[model samples]
Target: MIAQLTALERTYAAIILVVIMCVGVAMAVVGRGDLFAVHGWIIAAYAMAVMVVLLRDIDAPEPWEEHFREYYDDPTKVGIILSLIWGVIAMAIGVWVASLLAWPDLTFDAAWASFGRLRPVHTSGVIFGFGGNALIATSFHVLQRTTRARLPDQLSPWFVLLGYNLFCVLAATGYLMGMTQSKEYAEPEWYADLWLVVVWVVYFAIYIRTLARRREPHIYVANWYYMAFILVVAILHIVNNLAVPVSIGHAKSYSLFSGVQDAMTQWWYGHNAVAFFLTSGFLGMMYYYLPKRAGRPIYSYRMSIISFWGITFMYMWAGSHHLHYTALPHWVQTLGMVFSLVLLVPSWASAGNALLTLNGAWHKVRDDAVLRFMMLAAIFYGITTFEGSFMAIRAVNSLSHYTDWTVGHVHVGALGWVAMITFGSLYALVPWMWKRPALYSARLVEVHFWLALAGTVVYVFAMWNSGIIQGLMWRTYDPNGTLTYSFLDTLVAMHPYYIARAFGGLLFLTGIVIAFYNIWMTITLPAPVDEGAASDLPVEPPAPRAWAQAGE
Candidate 1:
């Protein structure tokens, strides 16, 4: 069975096993305390499990035939599984943090359970762990299909997938250990950042190589958005994470920039991390999956091209809006604001294009749960972008900044746009990847969709109301020009909204849990057999779809 594996697969397995063993030994020898020791044990146990799996596969019989051997999807399968796992973890943490806000004593005085430490865990887990893996997986799947070419190599895909997840693990664990460079959305310490750089470079190389070998003359618009996401994220990550590590073994690091410069640099990274990482990559998913599921061509391929370039160009300049009224130069702030407002054009263009593509498919959008998710995501994208532009204006920023309004806006995109699109894509892909006819439960899909929509709406409204109330209270002045409301009074007022936010998050999480179960059963349950079948033979797979055939 081991002999059945391609040489590359065997080599990868051996290398991973060796690396895991070496890391475990090193940690056992020089780990600082119980935390490090426990981590080492976990690594060792995981390595052992991996070894067993490899050995079992080695002993299995080789396949008699290898049809559909042109494409690589194992990495995608791994990514989807990891994405679901991380989604649960990220949302659970988010709910817990919301609870912390509502009931401050929920932390129980434990440092590790504090909101500050866990907040990054939620953000990084969802963005990088959940969303990032989905992007990586779908990008590979979509890029290959759109280009009509296979990935450059099998090993590189595995390296990027596994190595990227490793970076996520390091980032999440480091946060728990109080190790960070203090950069929003770039919280991973110096070493973790370096690891991600290496992984990202390999990903880029694989993508470019595959594109170069494409059978199609025109690169699909989806690939363009995906490429932009990869290129810009690499540039932003490296630039923002230029820090000096205390030592090779230690997690401590100091940023290369300081003071006002540091603040500007951090927000520059923060905002664009939203733009490229969260927005662009998922837009790539939207472009591919939406049309494929809707059975229609893109509304305007030309508009997609325009929106892609416009968004990429405009987003880089808009980050400074985050520093409105800060020590950053006034002109720079204004520049950020102007660019942010201009960003609405391309944002709405993309959203409109997506919606217009569904012009004759409204019935499908209404009937199909997956299409509903994508359509809602596109709609939310427009709403969030419009709101973001409005809030960037100086006058609006004066009220929204330092308030939960910004939080609400972020989730309008994060939960409504990002997660919704991701869920839709996964619903469309999981059965295909597993060679199933359909989802295990369509009813569950419908249920999950309504839960997600309800949860997101409730969550956003609660935050918006709390934020406006807080802003009003802060700005209210008495007849004598003294503050009318104290800070504690605002906190007391926010308690109800915070509780609502937590309840909303719980609803969202419940939906995710249902999704996970449905996917799990879809993959594991035996396919239903035909009633009148005479012989006991495996069913032949269906022929490829038109788009898939064209790509090939």
Candidate 2:
């Protein structure tokens, strides 16, 4: 039993306890201002907690790690396929919603399929289903490569994939069944939410265990973002979704908070859901795959660490900016705005770092479609951060709030930054995961990139113009002290912008379908392999020392 306490296990067990103690002491110290005393107590409490957990862990036998018994990379293949499938579905629904906005009558008078119902369906499907699957599939691949070990048991990996997709199925079906909590992002009812909680916990445990067993001396930067995404999302989901189901069959339930408090909590959850889930998670993919593809080292190791911690700390407070000019305390609003503005530092620090990493690789920027996508994403990351900071200012919020300008800001991040990076990573990952030579058509990739870019720019500018026009018109007053333009007039004025947006969406959808077809052809095309296969696949070599510059 004494022999069970390996140095590594003891180290991890101690760190876990220190983390717990730090959390508790943070709460207490914030509650009271006796910092010196609290600091001393916190250190003691952390040491004690570490000892206790370590003592318990000492007797527990280490788990037996699993090896891949099957010859085929079924999980990787299936996951990639599912991610592509869901991505198309999600984008299709998104285009449908865009059309619905352009012309509300497209709902066809079906209550189950109306804009109110379908909007959430599209958002959840894309954000959770498409983006979520992509992250999981790629993380699994990256984890394996970085760790130099096979994933946990095949069954559990399957569980993480199928179980998650099953949750998505339940969620989409429940919405069609008119079952919902009506929360913006957390729309799934309690049962579905509960199901997701279980899947996510397994996801987290698998990730941690994988990292723990890694052969590398230091963890990769991508793993940091991935793990942060898993951990913080767990905390956010549980905190924001404190609800009791009326019944399993019932579609309705109440949140734990009420009134303005509820609004605060909802946006708090909503905005950070964007920050952690959408932003930080993809940033991890960018950090790992971009430099790997470019055959370049990261610009600065210190900058990456700064960005990581800065984003982790600053993002939580900036959620209140979503509720600006509301009844949330003035101090809270102030905190949100300040952090949002200051967030530009770390955000651009990351963006600049990525861009600078390409200093010697500018020629590749012209020749490599993957680098082009990633570099453009970094540029847009800088743009969106600037826009977000500007929008957080009360003066700007008064004009842009409840307008198409905000929609433009979001799409800049979504389409330009997040989707672009995902595409880049997928372009690189798909071939590597499948052991294919390269993409079927570089020309198709170029066409896809240009179409996506044109569509995004057109869509963003149209909405920006429409939103600002509407905002100004709403606040415009006649010199004789009467409203200058009715709301109907503003809506009518937006028709042209809406039409342009729909056209852009159509182009974007077509480009995605083209990409899907291209990838499909790549997979289905004939290939050659040696007749005599080795009994054991070769292990991946450790990442080069320069690769260390990316994340640590």
Candidate 3:
């Protein structure tokens, strides 16, 4: 990967790392005796190590002329690997988290391992660490293909990839150290959030720059969704993380908004983080790879347009539904509920468009586990989006709020939609990326598909059961008008379902393990040349651009 850069580029990379190292050292010195100092040391050591690698490779040869002709994919490759590793780690932690609730003594007296601290580690790890990496990696692949142009530069992709990972590392480690601003989904401290803002700006710049370099007459739908993901997420992260740090040395901060404003700001960020980051980005992946793999054009281009605009316009307003029946004014909640229900139109449109694209590809769906993964993901997308709309209603929110139903709804999206589509895209991408005819073992792919499906079903079902029982128990009353069940009673009732949820999560994690191994073997093992494999490689690399020929 380092050899992909020119000598000058390598030197530039080293210089960038030098600046990061200096920042880390300054942080370490100023934040002595604090956990923030630990992160400083981590950052410094990481930067120094990467800087050394760049320096050692600084004099190495630049890529051949053929390199600039092709898409820059090193970052995507590394991003995929990092994403898989994080997915396995985070999903395992998720299972452990579920077990903690069931047993309530599984922490083993470790403060860092407590449910409060580790839950965010699990959430942020999978969401940002795993899912974020996948989105960035796949976006690079989709963008270059859709635009018929290479990335604007090599170094910026790595900068965005590594810098974003640094933010993930900071957020995860800080959570373990109990350093949080207490906002859901935006838990990282002020410095980490600021670092992300810087990284995201560069990411957005890279997208715009690449689009400017496109040879195509028009941007593809995939780029539109990916751009929305990039643009909207940057806006959401910046606004929600606006905080005043107590001191530069301290890993603590107060939000710019407080009271109900803080609550509103947070859910706004939270919901749209789901909208753009999880839904929109993966929809981009779907728009590209799903049709490509199925050998069909999208069913309705106009519907795709409707889906994009509707989601973009509506999702921002739906966040207030999360505050239903709270101190937040009823009108705001009603507005949120209305938007949430209306969001179903575009949500279903996107889902329907994906499914209809497979009209004549049912044979492939039957024979190919990879396509099955994507198809099920679309189905789940439809189901979960509908569930979200249903739960957003004030009456439904009353039962679902603070219950395991909400958790179920999220996992439907997380496990069923996000993870499924990601794995499907990766499975489709890995062989093509590694230049293999097919996977190392098709049987393993089948095994993984079934495991993932079974896991999602069991997990969601268990949560649904757990949530409804809890909701009903909490609201049930005796003749004396007192609640019939204590919170503990609900816990005891949901204990079995928690165990089931954990087991289901374990199944899902096992599938990811299988996927990682399958992908690793496909990359490492030699391909057997055969007729079936010869025609599978893509033929989309455009003629080298004029500036690229000039070695710019």
Candidate 4:
């Protein structure tokens, strides 16, 4: 095992271990009995685990071929594993928070368990922890394969993966410790935000370095989307999170912008976080994985190029729509609305391109659970983007703003689109990474598909109903022009829908648990032998299609 690691891996592992130990010690010195103390102890234990894995060489034995060393990096496997682990943790927290919304008494008198704190934890856990890892992992895998070039350096890949996750850890724990900049999606305080900037810059460098070394004549469409996501996110994050720290040791900070400017900045960051982080990054995943899994080439590379440019141009201006009916200037709000409405064209262009790519692969869509997941994801992308466009309109925004409808719209993208696509990609990725012929259980994949689909339907519909009802009740008027329904009356009406949403979350959580079990078994269990093969011999699966091949 030790013989297999290049000097680069050993050096990176040692650096990571030292950093972990140092951070743990620093936390102990400063954080004493706070949540940071608990975080420090966990870091120490994690360092020990890393020591054992790095020293013991738990990776499978390397292939004998020399060329195998030049094409792929193994850190992608680690990224995938972390993505799934974080997905489960995030969804579990999401379910707990949903239950809290339904029954506020569930807080159990614990301030840490309150919805405000845990909400950020769930959002960051899923967005940065789960979704971020997926982007990193898939981007690395896709960039190499599409470019037909090896990563420039092994150590940098590991550094990006571990460093990005460490930032996620800090953000999550900071939320629990009541640390925030009070920005919607950019809540992590000054220090954590600065740490992320360092990590993200390294990430961008890694992408550019790999691209510069590509053997392919033309860069693939997918990498363009990924690069846009990486670059635009860095800009948005730095601009939105600019603040003055109270002290080097303290976790508090004040925003550079105040009042209306601050609100505009936050929503701009918030909406675009959805755009670039969730939508653009995942679109990159779709461009590669969807067609690859369906055994088809992209429907129209030209259309994809158009969609890519359109989305990037339109999404940035659309953030001001989130400030509709607020103190933000009316002209700015109208401009945002127009841009958001225009965004629908490019959004559908991408979604349609994916669906059309599967034109001849309907049979695969039926038989392959992975394809089913990706197909549903594309459909949801279309639905959610259309819904978003409508909601951005001034008339529709009047009813949708501050309502569960917005929440429902988000999950249509998050749970139905982002998570489904991620699960499908991972299902495809796990077997390849572990050198297994297939997943441990195909039946479990089918079961999980249904569970996820059903859960999303129930959850979205419940929220839609709740939102519309709340909107109607709020605007209702008596003969004397008094309110027709009290706010408490609307709350009472929403109780059933809240409970239904929680049930939907429970169903989704069950699917995630099943997926985790399947992935675990795939890694740990031995491959099955063919019917007529020797007992000691395991069957190797057929090679993937050209587009699906790793490192080309």
Using TM-score, give the best candidate's number: 3
How many Å off is the CA of 306 in candidate 3? 1.0
lDDT of 1 by residue, 421-470 (tens): 99999999997777777899999999999999999999999999999999
Could you tell me which residue pairs clash in candidate 4?
A: none
CA lDDT, candidate 1, residue 333: 97
Better of 3 and 4 by lDDT: 3
Q: What would the TM-score be for candidate 2 when compared with the true structure?
A: 0.83
Task: Give candidate 2's error at residue 417 in angstroms.
Answer: 0.9
TM-score for candidate 3, please give it: 0.96
lDDT string, candidate 3, 1-552, tens digits: 687787678878888998999999999999998887888988899898778777775765666677787888889998999999999999999999989988879999999989999999999999999999999999999989888999999999999999999999999999999999898889999989989999999999999999999999788898899999999999999999999988999787899998999999999999999999999999999999999999999999989988999999999999999999899999999999999999999999999999999999999999999999999999999999999999999999899999999999999999999999999999999977877788888899999999999999999999999999999998999999999999889989998999999999999999999999999999988777677666776554444343333454
Full candidate order by lDDT, most accurate first: 3, 1, 4, 2
TM-score of each: 0.92, 0.83, 0.96, 0.91
Best by lDDT: 3
Q: What's the C-alpha lDDT at position 312 in model 1? A: 92
What is the alpha-carbon RMSD of candidate 4 to the true structure?
5.7
Which of candidates 2 and 3 reaches a greater lDDT? 3
Supply the TM-score for candidate 4.
Answer: 0.91
Give the better candidate number (2 or 4) by TM-score: 4
